[model samples]
Target: MTVKGVDVASYQPTDYSTKGLDFVFIKITEGRTYTNPKWVDQRQTARDADLVTGFYHFVRPGSMTAQADYFMSRINLVKGDMLALDWEDTGVSNAEKDSFIKYVQKKRPHTRVLLYCSRDFWLNRDTTSFAGDGLWIAYHNGKPGEPGIKHPWRFHQYKTTPMDTNTGRFDDKAALREWARSKTP
Candidate 1:
């Protein structure tokens, strides 16, 4: 079976409920300049609720290492906490995405560093199909786990409105947690 989750950015409320979610991917940084204003409290809330927490960085035009450094230096990550690279910027190249993933992997060899992108981006822009540990695809098909693509995915953000809803490719929440800390996601 698949596990349900949500992804949130600074715009979302920190006091949101976790009644039905097994995980939460919170945007922590964008580029090297902005850090999600609500990250600390939102992350704390997820931890308090025992939801698998994930943090993502929105890529921008600049030094990949500097951005990684900026992102890594801001938060204290624990086990089962995922790290993802948001690849939506039109200016950032595919090579940069791969570089960022590689940089993060070198730093946290055991942690999962996922790639977040739309189906269009993956089909048209992607050249390497290198989504680090896994791909967190945004394909609003209403049917979760169906990204409509042959490429393997770990999480599917199958809907966006009413907040970005997702379904993970895990046997259950326990498997999700195990993959979060394991290199095999």
Candidate 2:
């Protein structure tokens, strides 16, 4: 069975659990400055709803270490919580992306780092330099397999209607749930 999940920012704070989502990835920070003001409440709500929770940082052009430090300082991740870097900014370089991923890994070796990028952006920007542990490919089209992505993706954001809909690569809900639970600190 495909495990359904949603990636949400401050702009989209509606309780997605009612929509039948099994997990959620919330945006915690953007660059080195902006923190989602609603993150605490949103996170609590998601947790209260028993949704497997994760956090993501929107990458911006700047010192990769600084950005990583900012993100790390803000998030309180445990084992089983997914961590991701949203690499949508075209201004960010491959080196910066690599540095960010490496810094996150060095700081939290137990946490799985996911790189979130669109298929078009990944191919156009040539983001093979990203060294995150998993991929969260965002392809708006219904089909994500046609992207020809060389990396094995764990999560695929295949739709944005109603909210961002995703499918995990796991074989069953139990397996995916086990994977999520194992990510805890």
- Give the per-residue Cα lDDT of candidate 1 at 177: 95
Candidate 2 lDDT, tens digit per residue, 40-99? Answer: 887887788777778999999988989989998997886677788999999998888877
**How do all models score by TM-score?**
0.97, 0.89
Model 1 off-target regions past 4 Å? none
In candidate 2, stretches whose alpha carbon ends up further than 4 angstroms from where it belongs are 127-131, 144-150, 181-185
Q: Which ten residues in a row have the lowest lDDT in candidate 2?
A: 143-152
Task: Say which candidate scores most in TM-score.
Answer: 1
The model with the greatest lDDT is 1
The residue-level lDDT of candidate 2 at 148 comes to 53
Pairs with steric clashes in candidate 2: 78-185, 79-183, 79-184, 79-185, 80-183, 80-184
Error of 2 at 107 (Å): 0.4
Predicted structure 2: lDDT: 0.79
